[model samples]
Target: MNPVSETQSQHDSAKDAFFMNIEDAYLTALKQNPVVENGRTRPQYCYYDGPLTDIVLHNFIQVPADNFSEFFSHNHLPIPELIAISHEGVVHFNEMPADIIDEIHQQRTQYKVVDYIHADSFFADPLLALNVAKQRNRIYCGHPTIDGLQICYYRGELPEHGIENLLHLELDQAIEFFVDTAYRLPTKIELPDELEDELKTSIRSGFETIVNEVKQQRRTLISQLLAQAKQVTPKFHDGEPLKIMLPSSRLTTVMQYCSRAVAKAFEKRGYQVWFYMEDGEMETNNLIKFYRNYIEFNPHVIFYVNQLNNLALNDKVTHISWWQDSMPQITEHKALRWRGNDYVFSISPVLDRHLALTGAKNIVRQHFAVDDEIFNTDGDIERQNKVVFVGSSYLNSVDLSRPEQREIVEIFIDKIDNGEIVTEAMAGEIAVRFGLPPAFVFWNLLHYAIRDYSVKWLCESTAMPVEIYGRYWEQDPDVAAHFNGELKHGTQVADVYRSARYALVSHPFEINSQRLAEAAACGCIPLVYDCRDVAEKPHWDDACLFFKTRWELLEILKTQVRPALSPTVIAERFTYTAAVDNFIKHSNIGELSQAKQSRISMFVGR
Candidate 1:
């Protein structure tokens, strides 16, 4: 090849490499931060403000503007448009567009026209607006100084300060907060004459609209809930297998053990039980695949163990579900997507009422039952003197750590302390506090209060010989000394229960834990809080000792307080077999069983 052509080829190759490097860097920055389709300040790559000469560049390699000679002079290509680290610890591509424009401008006489890049970039819109907002002191709750969602502060000194203190809030929550404080804002601080009527009226109108929508939504949700209250006649066919659906993954050891116990109980009762286990695995991700598989199995009934999804079911098949965890009041009140389950069961009585009030007609309250064969301890095993607590941490559980929990706890305490627990004034106060149209704070208040009480009671209660075992308790210094590490879920847990003389229980909700029943079978007594859900029953008083206060618990622990019911009696009362029997009886499966109707063939035609 000619010498001129060879040199031209090298320059062209260098240009391609530079552009490719720029593209790669721009794409990388986009992936590092969250993408908001219509956001003002989120990091992104888009249009340039002006031609190559107009914008100032930072932390970039300076290349001579008028030279292709410089590119050929170096052996390797210079990727000037790649990411540059700024002095202020920010990751950005500085003057990235200018290099691209310079390269394009060199090839073309006039400015290169690009249609897609239109007026948004690090240099053009978001950064400039942010700086302007900072100067004007208008950026409120989302100031850069704040870290995470917890701590936030507005930077500006305000003329009407008390009226518009922006707390760290979600988009919807900010709107609600504005309306909540709007009336009070007008009363305290005088606003500009032009801003007064317009802003206040706008907020009041929005508040009115939201109130109307909430009422409408409640009606709609209740109607949808009432639709789910269909009664299906039970067609219990003997020898037909009962199909059980479990999650495809993250099945805990305790769940697996409990599920096996239920399955074994069915087998013992002369009905065939089929688990969806295939190739030593029993799980599926697709709803269609599960449905088709269920159809093929042709089971008498289907039981979903805490599964919550919509799937088509065979008309004749009986469907029932069991939910173990509690959701917030708003979440529970909203219509749930279920696969036409005829009956719904909840472990917590708190949940049961929540479901009922929200329109679930056939709601049954149930509890976790133990398989005595697996959980049983040797009668002569020496019981340790320490009082053991085997469960997960309640106060710091994922459900309780949400943004709403703190507000809920504060409001509940305030109302109770004011001696307005059952008053209309308290209800109105709660509604305003939570931004609920009406007071739906009962479940949330009870659940969180109980959990907080449990934590406080444990820390302040008697200095009894105690050992705590659960995940995430190691961080808490109070629990740190007593923490005996996380207890393994299955029979190993039962052994721990057996070793301890008494198991301390303080469940926030009414959900009967397997540990309580297992402890009894292990010849360990259970000392539980006298919460309505846990100790409401007469039988519970007989089987387990109940305490209302820290002093009450301390008094009991001063001696080796044995339960009134014997281990055998407790085991007999709380076994999976007994649980299953109760379920079958309560569900009215036997009475509603399909019976054969007498039929005679007509011979007159023959």
Candidate 2:
């Protein structure tokens, strides 16, 4: 016999045996009655009997035993002169009623039929039950006489009988029932001490075999990954200058700009820097490519954004993971453990504490800086009397079905309305309590809720004309009316900032935003939402105005004047050069500093 044929035969035999067991269980259940205590039915054979019945009845219209004749007449279906009603309320016909049966079968094509099985017939093949729920039109069973089940109607003009809505509820309930039933254990049985001891020994041996198999599989996977990494040729030489490698990612556009700025900063400091391009592959493939790049470049330092997976690749090389976003915001890198040589940089103190709690050893608090070449102005462009906001509207993407996410958005709105600060820590604590994804709660829900509320309030309450420049603002008609055309990332955004007299900066977590730096560099006074604590003393505080509430922001727009700082001063203070210096100061990269100083001395002597 062919091997494939033999394997298929074995599978069929096993499936037959499985269904036989279900049939036997159903036959045994028919002979017993459910125990009733305090007028409530206690399920004896299957634990899911009660819940399944309730779900079926809730989504379907059940015809009582006495009303069958009236129902058949009302629906214009012929009823047999003599019919037998079973204990389960299924109608059975004696003698051949071929014409009537044909008519009933024709009705099945137009109306959805749901079989409401009694407790005695409560053996549901979980796969079949799920398929029925997916159909959203029918719940099929065996012959009415065999299963002793009654058919329920799901077609009607009533709102409760809406097929789509009812099927959604049915699908959710059926999934829960099947999942719970699959995990339930059978009733315990008493056995002889010698027999039980033998069974325990057999189970322990089987468990050890499974554990060994898992370990072997893991080792094989690692070996395959290492082999793939070794196929690529090295990209650097042995006698080259000290090198820094920055791997590109598709996580966000902001990360891409930051990487370019960092590369330029290191190049100026007399270090060879290069960016490893990403080819838009799967994450695992990208990870393999990253390993290959590590082996090829052999750089002294590797800088990445929000990724810590390659920290343990080499101990001698320094791995810098600058987390501009919060830890919870990047879900993919959460499981990667940090190494000793890994330097983790966070923009917010709240995020720093979060990393500490998660056992990160070397964490440095750093602020984001703008690329001077892209965000600087020539002091020639005419400044407009307008305030510009450049960000995507997160509120339009919110799913209100999730109560926990909706509650977080409401809390942020309420706080903003009452002239109170909604900090990142508060949103993070609520996310932890509700077991919700922190990124969704903080960034998507709370962040956009605040933006929507504040922007709408500013447009309606004050005479100041505000213009938005991003996507999804059209979701709200009122906000869309004030939306200016979208601007491109690099020079266009800088040009707009240079033309505007004021730039509105709203952050979800009160963290240092790149927008503040960019706006200030373009000589635009930043109107920042007051959420960060005063102790942090953000760099832009001296060059920008802060507003705590909508009222305060209104007053600032109406009365406050721009700060006295020049664009050159603000640009020098917040450029990527200053940012990289701060990073090198915190990091112990002394050799690069010495090399930079030597180059400066040579230039001065020349």
Candidate 3:
């Protein structure tokens, strides 16, 4: 109404917009900056970092892993297959297929790196629907592969140094060039007594000197990736997401969640976002409507988050196709892969190595957030010596055709029960012929079966005392067969847990398990297997004994685990509030508090 008021309103709106971008920018900058020595680069990919992650700095941490980020007491968790890609031209392929895994061991290969840059991109079907058409194809992993995570970089003209001609230096050589490079600062090549004597003046100066040297070195490496990013002839990338695509079937739910997190982070910031789940509906009429407005509206930015890029998502969108984890096709190690986003996000803290590789100067760490709402309800902490599982029914679907493998599982199961191991024939019949893998495949599997099996087995094994409870086990026949006819199914799990002492956790090979949290909530002190490939933590050690092989289970049975939990503590932790909060805080969404929530919010209008 009044001129003065209008002016102020406009200024404030502009200010908010500016500050928001600044926040995103500042956070992004953290990725390239070294945690300690500004010179040493680590990729800030995933939230979890330690001796293993510190080895080679990653950039922004992948969102899903960052969400449920936790360290086990023992390094006994199973590592999933991950895909990782870095600025350094697809660095390491760690999470190889099982056959490749065995071959690597058979050859005793300490480490081997593979690169599949041969793939290229080509667009087809301009208005191809997102979800529908793909489903009709009835297949997995068959989309045209696009290299470079879909994002393209192009600076106007060549800057004297041709990118292709520049010898691609090894990362170490690049880092070494910065660290140990011969710095002839117009004086003696060697820092003799003069510089050595300077240390006596102030410790700060000595540190500054090291810092300055590293900074200069970092510049050289950045120049390599950017100025030297593939020596193609100088041209402008009016680039768009190519029609090219790839099947993401193998890319687990964790991958989907990470992409969602990454997309949402940007959406909250004001960038218009579009994520085409293979199942998303993008049929022509809608596609045309989406396209017409995209062109008519002429949005400010277009962002893409996926395993590829370079396709035109309606030419007007400022397409930024980024992979949030390790390029799955590249890095085989899931941990390393999940942590590496093809591009960068604002919620996570980035490691320096990746910043140098991507030549990304403005990078930030966006972490997932804890809701504190899900774990809000009260739980009747069952203090019983029982185990419970609350996940998939995979255990009941084993295909027992593989008797040999079945034997291993039975042996594993027997060890799980402190030696009342199931015979191969028994396990084989239950797994293969019974339409499943093996009942005793792992800690995760153990979670599904053992609650009832342990209870039944204990009932039969030694009267050593046991009870089992879970969602699906009650519906199982094996448990029914063991039934001297005790209560089965439903809240019976909670009942058994309430009465039990040692709450068994089917943690087996996973770095993390939902059961661990559930058991903790139910006040069941878990008998957990120590998985090594993931994080190791304090309470984990205090709470559960970490074991691997069945033999280790014997040691656990003899010690570590106890019979009961203080009922009060169980109520405190397992309450819906605690459960939800822990899941949220530890989950990737927790990192969103630290990220630009604008990304996810942006898509809302779309």
* Best-matching candidate per TM-score: 2
lDDT score at residue 584, model 3, on the 0-100 scale: 33
How far does residue 384 in candidate 2 sit from its true spot (Å)? 0.8
Q: Residue 185: error of model 1 in Å? A: 53
What TM-scores do the predictions have? Answer: 0.50, 0.55, 0.31
lDDT of 1 by residue, 113-191 (tens): 2211111111122223222122112111221211111112222232222212222223244334433221111111212
Worst 10 residues of 2 by lDDT: 13-22
Instruction: At residue 44, give the lDDT of candidate 3.
Output: 23
How far off is residue 47 in model 3, in Å? 58
Scored by lDDT, model 3 comes in at 0.34
- lDDT against true structure, model 2: 0.56
Cα lDDT, all candidates: 0.48, 0.56, 0.34
Which 10 residues in a row give candidate 1 its minimum summed lDDT? 115-124
Lowest summed lDDT across 10 adjacent residues in model 3 is found at 126-135
RMSD of each: 19.5, 20.6, 28.7
Of the two candidates 1 and 2, the one with more favorable lDDT, higher being better, is 2
